[model samples]
Target: METFTEASWYEKKENSIVKCTLCPHNCIIKPGKTGICLVRRNIEGILYAENYAVLSALHFDPVEKKPLYHFYPGQGVLSIGTFGCNLKCSFCQNSDISQNGIRDPERKALTDPQEIINEALDIKGNIGIAYTYNEPVIWFEYVRDVAKVAEKAGLKNVMVSNGFINETPGREMIEFTDAFNIDLKGFTEDFYKKHTSSSLEPVKETIKTIHKAGKHLEITNLVIPTLNDDPVVFEKMVEWIALETGENTVLHLSRYYPHFKVSLPPTEVKKLSGFYKIAKKYLKYVYLGNVADPAMGNNTLCPVCNSEVIVRNGYKTWTSGLDQQGKCKNCGLKIIEHI
Candidate 1:
């Protein structure tokens, strides 16, 4: 109970009510009532972030698992997440945490930034900390403070997010964050509004803003079987990434499986492969995720010489193709990623 902290990005309203202004939702919360994310509660006109430092899940995972193929290819990162997500996606992978308030009372653990940094440094090849699992933006205060601490500790900060943050907080994140894998969700505003309960323009602005900060930025598009898999929309999205964020942006076209409220079947492997090929036309690096069938899209080929630079099979990444300066060994082309 003492862990609760007054949330930022919200305003105290009349009659002991508070309205959350964090994301575009602009939830008008009543006393003792939580917002859509279920983490921010309005108590006596005070908005509190209940999930601050109350982690529901944590694990040390490969950087690629964040689906960030461009940044630090083979290194491991300490992945951590708290509950509550601003977006209500029907196909949330970590819905167990993203859709709920907190983990079960028995499952909750309190972890401070120092402890996380200590563990990250303790690991031999641990690159940094990656905030994942649920949408990290809703846990804004904790993420911001922890990110600053990690930056000072010489740890690279990574965010696996929905890219739903507003300009103010998003800019602060870029100050310390080294890499990000943002999900564009869907290309159309309707998909964002109807499926995710969010807006598309803010996400697009977030992507542009992140790229301008010179941070390593990658993207993922969860290919729902029918919701967002239309080739026309997908192609447009790839084109937008190329023109707005630059063509070198790495994109991971992940296959969708039935989860949470959505009961649709898994996306067909053929569909995943087809989209991967389409994405290659506009982006320099593209990968297929979720399933490992023929395994054609997991390897990274040089955009110049067409040589397989990095090979991956279920997180086993080989980086011999990249020289000490992060360029292709054969062609010597300067790629944007750190590793």
Candidate 2:
């Protein structure tokens, strides 16, 4: 039997029930029962993070693989994730790890935050650690612990998340996180409710919170066929990002593939290109993912002079056209984040 870590961001209530404050779910867990995430349980009026020290997946990936275009373009990150998620999305790409809560005793036995830091240090050219693959918010305690250690070692911390966390915990997490890739599933509340079983307002709030904190942030919208691919709705989303998150906000429009339950046809390249045109109107930095055309999505251009500054070929990024200060060498336009 795997033990649990006492969780933060929760409160005790009457009849030994505990209300989880980690995310918008605010699940009121009864004694000996779990929350909506299925990984946080209330035991004698105290909430415990059941997946605290569990590991579902671990690997080293390019920063671009996180789909973060504006933050440390070519760096590699040590990505780690545990099982459990706050939302129930029908088309979850990583459903095996996200939907199923951590249950394997063997996987839990190897849970060590210090080991993560050590492994991160061992990887050559590894810039930092990324809490990714599954929803890192649900693994809050473990992430916080590892991040604290990683910070002291001068390692950057990146979070790949759904951005559904409550303000209190979200603020705390951002303190230690250097960069973030938040999934803005869709533009409408109905789309969110029907497809993800979650609301949209909290996600928007989380984006604003990250932006206001002055952290490196990027947004990914997995364009699904007939679900969130409306040109008008996508225009609204782009406009909102420009107005609220600013024009410099990095946006990635990803091509959705048949996955999990919702097996819609793969997004057409033409449709994604159309969205690219719409987003380009309001955003300074935009890219497409899961597509092969380098000219279409793998290069970054200077907003001032329209010169390609960084060229990326499936994570093998070349910054020859960018100066040491991340400026366009041709016109000296500051277009990327300096390392």
TM-score list, all predictions: 0.96, 0.97
Scored by CA lDDT, what does every candidate get? Answer: 0.86, 0.89
In the range 62-98, model 2's lDDT, one tens digit per residue, is 9999978777778899988888899999999999988
Candidate 2 local distance difference test against the native = 0.89
TM-score of 2: 0.97
Candidate 1 CA-lDDT value:
0.86
Off by over 4 Å in 2: none
Which runs of model 1 end up more than 4 angstroms from their true locations?
105-108
C-alpha root-mean-square deviation, candidate 2: 1.3
